[model samples]
Target: MSDDSSMLLDGLPVAFADGQTIMEAAMAAGIFIPHLCHHPDFKPQGSCKLCTVKANGRYVSACTLPAKDGMEVENNSPDLNDKRRTMLQMLFVEGNHFCPSCEKSGNCMLQALAYELEMLSPHFPEFYPDRPVDASHPEVLLEFNRCILCELCVRASRDVDGKNIFALSGRGITKHLIVNAESGRLADTDFSLADQAAHVCPVGVILEKRHGFAVPIGSRRYDVEPIGMQVERPATAGTPGTRDEQA
Candidate 1:
């Protein structure tokens, strides 16, 4: 590969360092790439394909794909947009996303992305997957029914906090709740309020107990604008580290 540090992403040239991923590069260039699992404070797990983009004539997860010199990337192509819409629809049907009742309705990333894609109604039949609510902890609420399985909290717990508290269980459509350690309760687990996992949940599934109804609908950050437009990439640090380093 060439030693150049810039690449053309959707007709716009963006510069990136040697180790930056395509998602990071695109964000740095002010290109909005819709994502749920990729958070700046957490490690990139790439579980959700919402950030999928065409690079060098191939589909790749921007969160995991390394940006290469001279590589051509198409982020907002018709095909990709269609795929994203379909994916969002599937996510909508796969879980019980009742926005009106959700505490995180306005600030939720999933809702914001769905609105951005214009998913007014879920066209597919509801999965209606039965998932138990785990509200054992006094400070945390675990509503498995609303989880998209984006694994943001899981990754944040495991990688950033070095506390492997949250983990997904089962496989395929049967995939259900997350277990926190052997006891399967947040309180029983070694997780603390300080753990990044507690704050990384994109949905209202895992929420801080105190802030349940703190922010009303239509007043939250994502409610005003899509997360892509609301959040800006912070200045990159000169050190080598995980996404937490940048934040």
Candidate 2:
């Protein structure tokens, strides 16, 4: 398995293509790396730090680290999993993620990763910060309570939608997502439900109006199965195509 184009991921050999990052190669090889900020369509930001992996005796962001030949990558381990779980817990407490009442409960990547990581509890005390919900837009709701600051929407809006509608401002604990309008309101912006940014959010931060409970509680995306299974699954249960392919 020690080929010129292969790298060792958890002792298993994985081939990599030129210019592919560790996350990209592993994902293409059916390996599921826990991540929130990484989407197949966008450039890897490594902002979430959920996909951290031990590489060559040091830790590196899998989403941004380039895959090198003969490199040793430890993705799944007790210590690594604990760190990932703690990260997930921190995200939960920092944000007001009430899954029971959240419209994106099942479809939310944050919630799904919590379930997949078997996050026992918040582990840390809740911050309970009072964030705002902007419902001024006619077709969308900006629920700050569920925002994880992944910035996928920001990238999608700027890079794909060709509309610089989203941006992150402030710093540290005060950091939050913002719209690019003078009024600081989504209604004042040119955001649309059909915009690529509208669909890139991993959590319930950005949601389309009138379809909060469209899929029902029990039949939503992750309710049917774990997020790991969903992404790693070769088929869409009985559907025609692969989720990875479509994603």
Index of the highest-TM-score prediction: 2
Model 1, CA-based lDDT: 0.77
| lDDT string, candidate 1, 1-247, tens digits | 4456898989898999888999988887788898888877656778899999999999999999999988899988888988998999999899998888887777677888888877777889998878788888887778988888888767777777888887788899887667765677777876666676766677778776777666555656666566668557432223343222122
- Local accuracy of candidate 2 as per-residue lDDT tens digits, 32-51: 88998888777888998999
Full-model lDDT for every candidate: 0.77, 0.83
Which TM-score value belongs to model 1? 0.88
Q: What's model 2's TM-score?
A: 0.91
Q: What lDDT does model 2 reach? A: 0.83
Tell me, by lDDT, which candidate is best. 2
Model 2, which residues run further than 4 Å from truth?
1-4, 232-247
Instruction: Write out the backbone clash pairs for model 1.
Output: none
Clashes of each: 0, 0
